[model samples]
Target: MNEIETAPSGEWQDVAARDQLDPDFPLGVEVNGQPIGLYLLGDQVHAIEDVCPHAEALLSQGFVENGVVECPLHGAQFDIATGKCLVEIGERDVRCFPVRVVDGRVSIKIVPV
Candidate 1:
């Protein structure tokens, strides 16, 4: 697999390859000790924080509809592409990361501070 970028902390790790992912299901990747949600919508891959801000639920376990991922526990909605919380129940925004496919290999650029 090809690496798009290293973590800000300079740690070496491999999340997953492009072919290993299921486009229809949410994939979980841990980079720099952070859990990231990886999903494929259409022909592009998106990465966001896996944890729901309103609760301890995993966003990856939530439902994805019309580009919005709804929290399974409290029914909070968030735009997966932008990580913006869509409902008033959860005002906190989820973190987003840059995802890129290089040479048929998928790699996500870890969000840095």
Candidate 2:
């Protein structure tokens, strides 16, 4: 499980430790009641909406490969780094949050940066 901390709106909130992220697996977290998925690509961390727009599945539970994540339920695919829908079944693109790492901790800003 990933650690979670709440913060005021537009502020960066600590979500997990940098060591908790895996290149092949995404971490699911909820910030201010919004489900978000955390992905690690190389040394960079990305944060995006977790829910599949075409269905009610968590994107974090999907299969990840080569910067893309495929919805486990309906086969919808999205770019993990850009949150862009890559498949027709995805319906639309998802929201992306800004991520920052400091002192071995992973933090994200839900508001547009």
Candidate 3:
């Protein structure tokens, strides 16, 4: 695990090491006190809000398959790369943060949704 770095709003903050992410699993992290999920798809990484809109469950803890994450609480699914809600139970699309990797560190720029 990597230590999360704090930064001002709208600025990129280091959340984890690039190697810490797994395609089969999502990493849950906090940036600016907001929950975010980090997912790896092929060679790219994506950051999205971790909380499920329908049940407030952590999406990072959900089952991930075919680039979709299913809510552990209510079976809602979301597209990992786009943060779009795939299942009706998801309620609405989640917020996505801009991500970048440098020196094996994963950083994300968080903005208010």
lDDT of 1 by residue, 36-94 (tens): 78877778788898888887688888888878888889998988899999997766989
Model 1 compared with the native: what TM-score? 0.82
TM-score each candidate: 0.82, 0.94, 0.94
All predictions: root-mean-square deviation over Cα?
A: 3.9, 1.7, 1.6
- The lDDT per prediction is 0.75, 0.90, 0.90
Clashes of 1: 0
Per-residue lDDT value at 82 in model 1: 92
Better of 1 and 3 by TM-score: 3
Q: State in Å the error of residue 84, model 2.
A: 0.6
Summing lDDT over every window of 10 consecutive residues in candidate 3, give the lowest-scoring window: 1-10
Question: What TM-score does candidate 2 reach?
Answer: 0.94
* lDDT, candidate 2, 6-73, per-residue tens: 67869989999999999989999998878999999999999999989997799999999999999999
TM-score of 3: 0.94
